[model samples]
Target: MTDSAAEARPPSIDSSRPHPARRYNYWLGGKDHFAADRESGDQIAAVMPSIRTAALANRAFLGRAARHIALQGVRQFLDIGTGIPAPGNTHEIVQAVDPRARIVYVDNDPLVLTHARALMSGTPGTITYLDADLRDPAAILDHKDLHALLDLTEPVGLLLVAVLHFVRDDEDPDGVVATLLDRLPAGSWVAASHATWEHTPAEVVAELQKSNRDGRFVPRDGDRFRALFDSRVQIAEPGVVSVADWHNDDPGRAPAADVMCNALVGRKR
Candidate 1:
């Protein structure tokens, strides 16, 4: 709950075009999205109905990864491309495990920044939000707020969950990851999930590619997503599996392959 004065000056939102964060919120059954977002979500869902499931699974994976990272004694978190604040956010999960945990969430979307303050108001100084994009990891790393909240000398959880697909090939998403990790000490960890078109039918892939022509999404295969970690970071067990399968306590049930999203939590060596 931002103060009335802060709330009065909300960030500008372009509801005419569907934003990825809002569309993701809509898919996750959140109320922060506009009509355009819902329309875009519906269009994508109609082609690949499993996206809704992927969204939920991705959210759960974030919680699990955050908790696991906190349990590993890492108190600081940097979550980039954090979409519209929803239940089970990184701060909530990490703070639950370690009450003194610190978190910095970065997102370029103005609507996300507005809703972020409201959702994060309860946990004041422990959490901070930065209006930044993933394309320039260096800028985010050098930002005053991020520097103030996170100690690069110590271990920090670098969370890139379900946001990398938004970075197209020309952007060198792998280099972005490396650059960020290079700035952190050896103990820091990277937990990430990315959308993929590996197991889907050719027609399904075509439809998704056509819909994502705006370059908002660039779904990759498991190999490419995993390669982002490179030799600098080592992935943990159950390496690069679907979000539903990664550290899932549910045991017996496995989600359908076509709807799966690649997920992994790697530690810097």
Candidate 2:
């Protein structure tokens, strides 16, 4: 059995060890992390220079996907692994298209939970926050707060942007995606931006991974990452391309060099 004391103490955050989400937040120019996250962010950036650009691209892709789905008339959103809020949050983007959009943001971070509640309150209508981890999809799905706010019988957009990279391979990532996607109805969509290193040379990926002590995440090759969508959903056009290559507003901006991630949008059949 897990030690209750260890679970209770929750470790003083060490402020030295690198955390992926916090580091990414730092890269995105968010002011919600400590010195350690900045240090780790710098370390990763030094090795993989496109880290910052990739983060920006990931955020942009989320906005584009939201707009695309909203235009298609899917108004309900189940945003798991919802990170710190910035411009173009799901509800804000969708509500612009249809004001009655219902959004539920889920995250395990206490800090994110606080920010989410603020974001929801500031938004126009029907917004909920569920303090749940992506690893615990069952707890997230079972959260009464969401069912009360969102309708499962209707098409819901499952947003997993830039978050699945935190789930290590041994955690059965494919199974995790399947479980979440399986629960939603026929027309629900699952969209994500996952970290990848295919464009980056192997040496760079190796150095960055080694520098983080393998903490950034398990680098899933294109094939393995695509396996997460297997047999469950119909991937949208331009399937699983580098974030810069996916439907972009500016093509002149050179494709983010050696992108460490890829953007994907899929619809459940």
Highest lDDT scorer = 1
TM-score of 1: 0.93
Candidate 2 — which pairs collide? Answer: 196-260
Give the per-residue lDDT of model 1 (tens digit) for 1-269: 21234445455867768888988988898877777788889988999887888888899889998898888889999999899888888988998888899999999889888877776688878889999999999999999988888889999899999899889899999889888999999989989999887888889888877777678788889999988886888899989898888889786534746446889998999
Candidate 1: segments with Cα more than 4 A from true spot: 1-11, 251-258
Q: Scored by CA lDDT, what does every candidate get? A: 0.86, 0.78
Candidate 1 collision pairs: none
Clashes of 1: 0
lDDT of 2 by residue, 1-269 (tens): 01233343235434445456567688898876667678778887888777788788888888888888888889899888777787778888899999999999988666566577778777745898888788888888888998998888889999998888888777878878988988899988878888777767778867876765656376666677788886898999889787777787685644745566777888897
After best superposition, candidate 2 residue 226: deviation in angstroms?
1.5
